[model samples]
Target chain A: MNPMQRVMTAMGQAEPDRVPLFILATMHGARDLGLSIKDYYSRAEHVVEGQLRLREKYRSDCLNPAFYAAVEVEAFGGETIFIEDGPPNAGAPVLRQDADIDRVKVPRLEDCPGLQRGLEAIRQLKAQVGDDIPILGSVISPFSLPIMQMGFEHYLDFLYGQPERFDRLMAVNQAFCVTWANAQLEAGATAIGYADPLASTTLLPRAFYLKTGHRVALDTLPRIRGSVAIHLGSGRGLSLADDFAATGTVAVGVSAQEDLGHWKLAAGKRFALLGNLNGVEMRRWSAEDAEREVKRAIAKAGQGGGFILADNHGEIPWQVPDEVLLAIRDAVERWGHYPLDWKE
Target chain B: MLRGGADVDELSSDLRCALESLERSQVEKVLEAAIRIHSPLEVIEGLIMPALEAVGEDWTAGKVALSQVYMSGRICEDLVGRLLPAVAQERGSFPRCAIAVLCDYHLLGKRIVLSVLRASGFNVLDYGRMEAPALVARVLADQVDILLISVLMLPAALKVREVRAGLDALGSRTRIAVGGAPFLFDPELWREVGADAMGRSAADGEAIVRRWAGEGAP
Candidate 1:
């Protein structure tokens, strides 16, 4: 089966030729290509080239050219500092006072230069390998926007101290997510990858997630065309996995610390689980050790069709040796296959 | 026999309330009321740090969100900023220290560690965030006895190798200690990155540094 079909089949809870792969290879690609992060974030050609080169080396189902989570905030008049090698980070809060909420409007794609560059890259990527593989566009989910605007600390204060204002702020961000996701769909991205690391219990209470984080995702994500994936899906995720699945997300990005089989049982077969591999271990451990981890995760959950092998969080590091990527690729090809009921 | 005969229970309760409210002014007011009867060290070690830790506990256990935790961190930073002048005066001739956050989301841990280091009687120098060269140069120049680094991501944690090599290149023997999310997730990261040791939180980090300093003290 083709890459798209493989992903679609697995996402649909049916058996495919093998479990599809969708590694978050954004920053890693930039570093490997030796492009300044400023250029990688602004130039579609660089992003497209980096992505294609990485894909050439290691086959994957998703082409995420833009993983800079700060673009939407930057477009919304938020301050950001572009580092030489790393992703751009949001500066001080955009909405300084309670009054700034009135000025909070959903930023248009055309208005956001950074996001526009990414969309253009996705369009070009589709034109190049669009038919054979799925191109996934990324957006920082509304729940994750607090870190962008008003900074993370102030964001928590806004969430708890001024509950009503926080709701209004999230409403503004949710609109942007909807508009942004729809535009990516229009731009030839077959899937929308929603990155909401803050939704986990590591940062929020389960009740708060179900009430605010889950609600925002449910209200908007389902409306997008093709597929959707929410990341950092651990931290009390086992209990709330169904709520996340109910958001119509086809894939869940969980950390390696998560029990994959538990997620398989909790979220059921309809959703594909992406990641469980520790990025630190992959970079720190030897090639053989990294491969061992890959095989171990596969052994636990690779049996079922609904699994996409990926790092738990962050893109794979550039410092990782090429042999490491090849080793993981080989493991994916060797062990990440379906028909679990097969007799060895 | 406290400095100003302040009621420890009453001051602790009030200070805790101020920090929970997350307003630096309120925290300042609590400090003002306490300092009349308490020494700066007593208030910081007794009142401010305890409140911040309580809030940190709430944040760690998920009763409070990250934003609240960040606010508590900001408040601690403000309190430390206010107290540093007196702290500097009091801790004369203490061992000099330097700290750098190698990555983001470091404000909380950095502040906590700074306060702890000062409270534990170290002359703390917060270098804030810096590139590799500046980080290495500052450590070498100051002859920083214990260099504490904060890293919040896997990439930054991995980048610790470069830091270790940089220190080696300069032939500086600054003992490096790492803290934050990456090390917390994988303790072996400390040894793997070739740091002198690892610290879990601000106080825990201070304790670790103290142990190392104590062992090294002639």
Candidate 2:
């Protein structure tokens, strides 16, 4: 089966011929494609070409058009600071005070430069690869979008000291998210990958997740025309598995700190599981070592289906050689098939 | 403020009430209380940490949320910042340390570490979050005696190793220590990252730093 079919099969909780390997892009992919970080940010085609090269090099089952998670925030009026070697960082929030929420206005689909560029990339990818590859478009979730606007501390204060205001801000953020997700879907994204990194243990509790995060996910999922995957980057605990599943995401991106077996049981058969390989480890280890680790992760999580192989987190360092990506792809191909012995 | 025949529960309750009062109290009031307390460590670990943990628990139980915890942590951070200069004035000269969340983008853990270190009389430089190794090496170059790294993610822990490697390559003599939820739960990681020590809580971390400094554990 092709990569798209394999990913769709896995998303449906069915067995694919092999685990659908995906490399959530890192700064490294841009460097590998010889595009400077500035070019990657300023030029839309640079980003698309980098994604295409990474897909071709690793033969990944999924194609992610952008490497950075700050795109949507940038589109929402957050100043973006580009570095020579690292991914762009949204500048210190434009809306620092709680009162500034009234000043915050959602951007139109065409007016958002980053989101527009992202949608165009998705359209281009769909035109190039069509249904042959599952193009996944990404957006920062409401919980994190506020973090981009008001700074982490300020947003947290509004959440606690001024909760009614926080709820209103979240409503506005969620509306934009719905709009963005729909635009991406209309532009040819087969799946929506929502990166809600701050919603994890490092910043919020599982209870807060249900109150604020779950609603955002539920509200945005229906707006997208395809399957939705919630990417909760590392930190916190694996308990988010059930929460993400409860949010009605088709897949939950598990970090390296979490055991896939544990999340699988927590999520049950309701949601597919993606990733747990430590990208930093891959950067430092040999291809052989990476292959061994990838094989172990696949064997552990691929047994009963609902598994798509990917890095536990993004922002992959440039030092991780191309050979390691190939090694990971080869390992998934070798060990990802179903109906295997659990004893192995 | 201990009552006659007070048990652990009563003392804990008293401490909790004291903390709640401090949380609501202006920055000056909290600083004054910190100075007035005989055991600043107890005030920090027993009073402040527990209060923050209670907020965290409230967040976990759904009574509160991230906003609440963030606000509480920020308030506590401000109170600690107010108390630091006075505490340092009383303690006289002390060794300096740099506390940070390392490569991760979460600053709450790093803030707690800074508060504990400052309360313990160490001059602390806090580098917030998502700090690269180069920035850390520059801090080490400034002659900070100890480097305290905290991270919530496993990938960020690897950045700790990168920082360690950078220091090693530079032949810097700064002692390295790491703590956070990930390291707290995974003991073997301390040795894996080659940190001089690791601690589970802010109090424990201060104690470890004191022990490593040859001042006897706090």
Instruction: Please report the candidate that would top lDDT against the real structure.
Output: 1
Least accurate 10 contiguous residues by lDDT in model 2 chain A: A312-321
Q: Candidate 2: where are CA atoms >4 Å away?
A: A342-344, B1-9, B13-86, B89-92, B98-109, B118-143, B147-205, B213-218
What is the C-alpha lDDT profile of model 1 across A1-344, one tens digit per residue? Answer: 88889988877777798877766677667676787777666688888988998888888777777657777787888766776545567776687777887677877778877778877888899899867888888788888876767765456667767877767878888888888888888889988888888887667667777877888888878766667888863333556687887888888887666687787777777678887877655655776786688777766667657787787774665455667777888877876776654324
Off by over 4 Å in 1: A28-37, A78-85, A91-93, A96-99, A223-226, A233-236, A341-344, B1-94, B103-108, B112-123, B140-143, B158-173, B216-218
Q: Every model's DockQ, to 2 decimals?
A: 0.26, 0.23
TM-score of candidate 1 to 2 decimals: 0.82
Each prediction's whole-model lDDT (CA)? 0.72, 0.69
In lDDT terms, how accurate is model 1? 0.72
| Clash numbers, per candidate | 4, 1
Clashing pairs in 2: A201-A236
TM-scores of all models? 0.82, 0.81
